[model samples]
Target: MRTRLMEAGLHDGATWRISPTPFLLTSADLSAIQSLGQHLLRFTHALNRLYYESVRGAQPTWVADYLDQGKPPDLIAYARMNRFRTALPGVIRPDLILTEDGFMISELDSVPGGIGLTGCMGQAYTDLGWPIIGGRDGMVAGFARMIRSLHESREGAHSPVASAEQRVPAPLPNPPQPSAARLAIVVSEESKDYRSEMLWLAARLREAGLPAQTVSPDDVIFTEEALFLAGSTPLTALYRFFELFDLKNIPKSELIMYAVKKGHLALTPPMKPWLEEKMAFALVHHPALEPFWTHELGADTFELLHRLMPKTWILDPRPVPPHAVIPGLTVDGHSVSDWKVLASLGQKGRRFVIKPSGFSELAWGSRGVSVGHDLPQTEWAAALEAALASFHQVPRILQEFRKGRHVAVSYHDPVTDEIVPMPGRVRLSPYYFIAGEVGTEGASAGPPSAKSVELAGILATVCPLDKKLIHGMTEAVMAPCTLA
Candidate 1:
């Protein structure tokens, strides 16, 4: 006898977010969130194959010279193309932090944005039957099989399209053909307030006939081949809701970046700003790359992401040899020689967060962060001298915060309308979709091919245990994560 996620509709008329009434999880926390979404999808394919084996010197040439310090060499050689090397990331979210030593993870997005509010709260709690966890249209069939595995990796990476009538009006889990070109989710002008949950996910893929919409980047146009909108129609799979540092205020973003660098536009999370970093979890706690991440992500997915990742650093300001210090921190016991000595401690000796390790607009939502016991010591030493004067351009990372863990939930009060229990502090997230394959072997994420990774919906949030900057949906207690 329960259902208060806005009476089972889960809100957002005009941002009336986070309330609660659907935060269960327990079939062993839903099989450890589907085995932590297949070990964080093999840790993003072993951090994109050990950052291309440190861009081929076979690992550790200062790991692709500190992730190509402030990147740009032709977008790091178009994210090391070997025709987009086993191209991953059709969708995969991971911000997790329930703590008390459980799901810490802290960041890994791949252009994430709550896909149509997790397929409209998993079809409103599985149409009231409620077993929800990637069933009940597994977040719209794992985002329609990751957009039909991006039209099976652009026509003939081993054909998969040419069915379901050149795409969209599918049979069940969307057929998605690019040959006729249609899908579009553009949204730029720096992610225009996530254009109302992508116009309610392009009105549920136009009520299943597909021909989805939700455009922006000035309603895209530039046609010499494709990318149309009010200018025509074309557009065969865009989905990028802008954030490779907002590609210079996107509008004629170089005509959809020279139409996906001349393949005639297909762009997924493929503009790879080093796969959107939080300093790739401080290069997975670099200590001279633990055996190239235990032989490129195995060894039980690098010891289960080195215990759900947390201890990170990457804040290089250079010049400091007064007999070295910073390795895995020491601070008050002496050993930190300048990050303005970790903003001259004090505030409970600052715990640490210090963000921005993405393309920049202060690195996607949560803007240039910098928590450290919630700022003060001269604004945490002016955010550590603007992350050490934008090290050659922009880079920052410090992590080691790990707090979130309160958990209760029952809000509905907008002026005592009733049902309010309030207790907060979650963050969960868990999305993992990935299917854009190239991993050959009769590869499939498209037609009759699936499970390269699935668990499509989780989100959660909660926040408020004396809030330390959680995120959107105001006061927090959001939902859609059931089982218990």
Candidate 2:
């Protein structure tokens, strides 16, 4: 393709900066252009038909019925005049034009427009100068030829006639561009130290020469004359039959920015009521939440959120749980009823591990005793009893001695704004005893190793709640000893 472009006079002598331009072409170019237009029209029609039929209540047989069902005149006018367009998967406006040398596609403004990078595929194909067969002049002709061949193969059994050219002599005029002044950013307030993060992100946007501001949900002012309030919160739904409402009056082209914390709050129910209403918004959260939002809310909604909140980015550092508590030593099977576990463990041996259920990072205490020796059993039992008596209400778990190396991992869940592994560091001091050497061959000797931190972070993101939550609850039960 590159060789062909060089062979032709396309890239001759003059230093020409490649750019997108509107142009007029000869009759041959127009014919090829018309062919491409027909192909795109068919594609659009098929797309709309599929979309309408796939909609929950829209039956495939009722397509014509719905079209004639007293819709607004503008909608009926489109269906009546552009029958082919109505048959497509979505509302698509195809703009085919003649460039100086060949045919070009001016636009494909579908129902959900402005598809960012994904929409650039056509231009990319053109720039590459993909070879054109069948007497075609340019990339547009190549695209048309490809679609024509596909259609022919599919219609081989049915022997269907090719679609007639429905190309408009001139391309439709471009819609008015949105004003740059209307741009804004929205963010979630649940983030820890959210204000600081917003300021930092806003500063970065300013540095990049983009006008951006971060506003929280509570801070948003939906004045009656400014914008429509269509979505309802949990509390609002009780009083209103439907969660959706229209303000009916607002200036056109006014963009209301939304910066949402992806996983912090349950937004699905509220958003469900406002599915049909369009609004400008974006979501920012840990990378883990990306898949959920993208898969659950369709690409269009995801793109809308990203565009309205460009400053949002995910920081996916490893995380460690905030707290952990391991049940202290117990006297036989007497449990808390006999004595306090911590005191028992402390008395039984000069060193004992304190592990909280459902928590990671074990704490160890050494009371000047050798590894092999044991403390007096009588003292151990008494201490356990005393500790158990002190904290009678809290639930606790007793874990068997786990002699091994320890590490931690961290992660973030965008669905719930809370950072997984709240405290980012895993406790590793006790692991040194199990390994014999304080500094193992592959592990860090000082504070928690980087690997442990990363592990804790990952665990925080993917670990099941039953496991992690139990650890947290255990930690809470042993909070007093954690401080001690």
Candidate 3:
């Protein structure tokens, strides 16, 4: 397996600890995780609607204002257009921290990496006779299905729903043949690290008889009529691997957006900058938006999300009025009026996390993240002040930190050639694909399709116990989640 990963160039030039086996999950854990995808999909839909309604005066205007901050006016207007307003991300991956009781969703990634890496890991483990969560080729098949569904929807065809048992990797249904439609997974230079893995994925899709390929933004052939990888190979849909903030640097970004805006092509994730914000989590926990979320997500889902989502707040710099205090936030049983009070608290009192909200280079990959308890008093205060100061240009969010439960994992020591036990905390990233047809007119306001959210694969990153922030690093043990 180590040789296969290295040869495939899926490690992104970084070597990680090799686990002897897949991370095992209990049956109960499997049940709870399988149901989480649909709820998240619903949340995305509701968030889209809330923003549009806020713009139209049906809801609070501040909701839209908050999301529109720090974003370019032209791009915001393009996202709010009627042609693409019904669109949502075709793929969703939530960062879940495994606790003693359950898991908490730290954040969601729309244009997430690790899809190809996780798919390769799943196939490798399944080949070893492990009962992987999404079967042998679930990730590849799920991704193909999503692209095919988008293509079919654009061609005015109804997408066939898959059975619960058939959610795993399976043969594509034969109703609306999408063999002729090509898919281009466009990776920008900023995202060159995962380019090799995406190339591997495109090859697998081609092997499955789907016309898919990975290309850089420069390789895309743009004409007034449509987009193509070359003059002859016309693309039906595109999977954007780059973030919206980096569009200025990406080659032919305007051409690609023009193609989608003119109805010449379809793009997954819809280029909506607001949908990519981490502040959406903070919006979910807002008291003023409780009725909106509960109405859209229903009582049961609302309750479930409340339990699973950590309390979060957007670091707004404006001073609080003397007559009022921040909602749902208090220190020492007193409603706090200012943000600096928390910075002055001791380590035990400041169990929180500060990070960029979104639309910035530091938003992803744990780049500008600071854990309050892990830092000194002076450093924590600086982090808080900096976060508040950057509100207008690059927003930041403060979240209640929930520590992961300690677990024992065994890995093969390359030098010693012996199994070694390591104590660590786990972060599970389950890739969910929205495979159902996305309607153009009423899809955003309608209920979520039961079969749309398909759980393809789960990647577990077990960091050493000493590491407070869990991410893909050289010291972490990377493996796929599986049943015992």
What stretches of model 2 exceed 4 Å from their correct place? 1-182, 187-195, 217-484
Ordering by lDDT: 3, 1, 2
Better of 1 and 2 by lDDT: 1
Estimated TM-score per prediction?
Answer: 0.35, 0.19, 0.94
Give one digit per residue, the lDDT tens place, for model 1 in 127-225. 777766666556655665666556544654434544533432233334332234367788876676667778777766665556667878777877677
Assess each prediction's global lDDT (C-alpha) against the native. 0.68, 0.24, 0.85
Model 3 CA deviation exceeding 4 Å by range = 12-14, 157-178, 439-446
Cα RMSD of all models vs. native, in order, equals 18.7, 27.8, 3.9
Q: On a 0 to 1 TM-score scale, where does candidate 2 land against the true structure?
A: 0.19
User: What TM-score number comes out for model 1?
Assistant: 0.35
Best by lDDT: 3
Evaluate residue 237 in candidate 3 and report its C-alpha lDDT on the 0 to 100 scale. 83
Q: For residues 1-484, write the lDDT of model 3, one tens digit per residue.
A: 7878888897543478888799988888878899999999988888899999999999999889989989999889888888777788889899999999989999999999999999998889888889889988888888888777676566552224644343232334733244765889999999999999999999888877688889999999988987887755778888899999999999999999888877666688778888899888888888889999999999898888888989999999999999988878888789888998998999999999999989999999889999999999999999999999999999999999999999889888887789999999999999998866564421222357633788999999999999999998898999999976
